[model samples]
Target: MKPNLIAARKPEEAATTHPTILRTVLEYLLDKGVQPFVGDSPAFSNFKRVVKVTRVEEVCEELKVPLTPLDDPIEVNGEIFRKIKISRKVLEADKVVNLPKFKTHSQMVMTLGVKNTFGCVTGLEKSSWHMRAKNYDDFANLLIDIHRIVSPILTVLDGIEGMEGNGPTNGRKKNFGIIAVSRNAFALDDAICSFLGIDHLVYTVKNARRRMVTPEYEVFGSFSSTIQLPSTVSTFERFSRAFSRFFVKYPSIDKRRCIKCRLCEERCPASAIDISKQEIDYQKCIRCYVCHEVCPQNAIKLVRKLI
Candidate 1:
């Protein structure tokens, strides 16, 4: 995707990184003599270019910290994935500090620290894994496997500005006004979920709990209203109980809102979306919602697929 085309399509959420908070962390890292490389690969190709638009590059540059692009891929020889490529910097890191914005995800239910690491996979490899897994549960397993491999030393949830609705990317930003930190992502995510009072059916949450990946965690702060959940979160438990093939939710594009940018088509891991026709083929869609996440115009909507 073109860097100019990949601009932040919506208004900046108040809960996004505050200069003071980010500076505080950077100062701490610098004081500790920790050489930090702050960078993230966006949902599309050319992360170095994408970061330029996010303006995160400016922050890193001002902090005098190196912004490392996760462009170089390193093959991961692991169970379930014979040859999955991850970012070289992640592998080289002595310690990984996971910083994830609290957002409700269309597929994973929530994009917490565990799900945030998916960015480390580099560009199209992220889409390839979705196509390979093909099922949400299997995809969740793939995420868990990658997390185990990367094994971030710390996880910090930037819930001060969180997103709900069809998110991780395209959603209305809410001021969640909370920051959570934990050594374990699973625990931190669970704590965040509990604080939100949302259901526990999140794929990463379920998988993490089942594998006993979460240690004891606690929530300190409180919020007035409960966070709104994405429409796709309901299928978590029902997915295993019955077929409900027709009851599944699928991503639909709003042509009026869509700029015909083809971002959805390019980012779709299942290759189920055809922007030319302005339709998503549910038969091929794994409901991964990568299209929804990357759509620069917020054109994609999750609607129930009626039989």
Candidate 2:
């Protein structure tokens, strides 16, 4: 099973999947005579540390399952890009179980099942996509293309506790207290959008609609919450391209809170951050917010230039 273990943040932060859920699913798969393994490639953090901090390793230990990082990349062609490298283990698996957290994303409106599969891209290679996709819609399309090839049979969304306001990491924990299962990730994400009253606000859902990928599905049960999306999430459907740069939010370092970890500098695709000086070169910056996403201290703040 692949779960969203993007960082070493605690399970309480809702940044990653809880170990309890991983265990429950692992046991069920074991009972079905399925040889299940747990794997993911965290974008910035070390895989061993992320698994340990999220306690996913504990679950794997208890279940006697093989827990490993998604390594040994193999090339595959997607509809959008050729020779896309994915973990060879993923392609060789008989069946895949996708487990994604319910969280608001600074780039995409939400990170659900489809986004979870992106973890298959293998470690730091993910950073380059941020530079290439360049926009929400393109990134959404890339995610969808990846989903098509790594197609999982089932997806279980963990909504019991979720992140809001600049998440996947670095956000507030929200108690949504709901769980959902689906056969199709696209439909699952679209349904959640309807539930959250942001059906059209998500670029993934919008592009999925255009591509006719999400099939019709009925949403059972109910959930209600006023989610605090990313600080700059308003840019998605509200403004014209010409004005987006003027109004779009960019990352700024709060030097007082920064710890000089250099993660922001190391992981930034644009090489715009200099922790020594606590500066960002906006001219070179792609506004990917990787610095903000990778920062452990939450020192990166979102600001608008007004120019």
Candidate 3:
């Protein structure tokens, strides 16, 4: 089987390299008559906005691959998930390739191959999921369920330059110039966790393992190279558990970085955030980390505390 390849590059180098990335993936799949579709649910609240910000449409056009926007909901696991939708084009395609950006996640620690599929859920549905899942374990289950259904034939990580500290958005960018790919999402993510020197047990990747997703799964080619990431930080899950906090290490407004934009509060699903005083109500908090994930200023930090 031809292995799916994930390449890494700096976001600043996008103009020079995105076309190559697009062409390589599209042609490889298209040559086998396997339809290729690229999609991601960015932290920015809307899929279209993500596309615009990433210029994915231009990349699709350049590669002649079709661009699909998933907007209809589908039921999974007896849950009436109105936001759980997938691209029809991807669903119908013989092969699905996932292109995910590598970055730190306030809730999950890092958003890599497996977490990228959250984009398949449509519009406000992504935010609603935070409320539905409520806690770390339940939310991890939801993510696993989505992965079970979407089941990308291949996953590629965009780790050339990824976010760290507080990420998925609103964090510092670091250069980890390596590309990785694999047939199995679990294996792909496992490799990334290893490369980053993070304990798989501390990440959702470990949660994936409890759900039986493992690194032992078959892999295609070896990673092109391993890039060094910055110094490590505690995963929110670990911080929450160790600190004995009901707050679950949710993002708190960094008054130094916050511009008082209210974006985090507006987008928060639990409405646990108070923008007026820039305070978070830990009692009402759900630990979704959406505020941290979506903050424009990277002003949110996952701090542990009890209500």
The per-model lDDT (C-alpha) reads: 0.71, 0.87, 0.61
Listed per candidate, the RMSD to the true structure in angstroms reads 3.7, 1.6, 5.1
Per-model TM against the reference: 0.88, 0.96, 0.78
Best by TM-score: 2
Candidate 2, pairs of clashing residues: none
Q: Between candidates 1 and 3, which one is better according to lDDT? A: 1
After TM-score superposition, the amount by which residue 143's alpha carbon in candidate 2 deviates from its true location, in angstroms, is: 0.6
Q: After superposition, how far is residue 164 of candidate 3 from its true place, in Å?
A: 2.2
| Residue 138 shift from truth in candidate 2, angstroms | 0.7
Model 2 weakest 10-residue run by lDDT? 234-243
At residue 303, candidate 2 shows an lDDT of 85
**Could you give candidate 2's per-residue lDDT for residues 121-168 as a string of tens digits?**
987889988887887789899999999999999999998999999886
In model 3, the clashing pairs are 6-180, 8-179, 9-160, 41-119
lDDT of 3 by residue, 176-196 (tens): 676677778778888777655
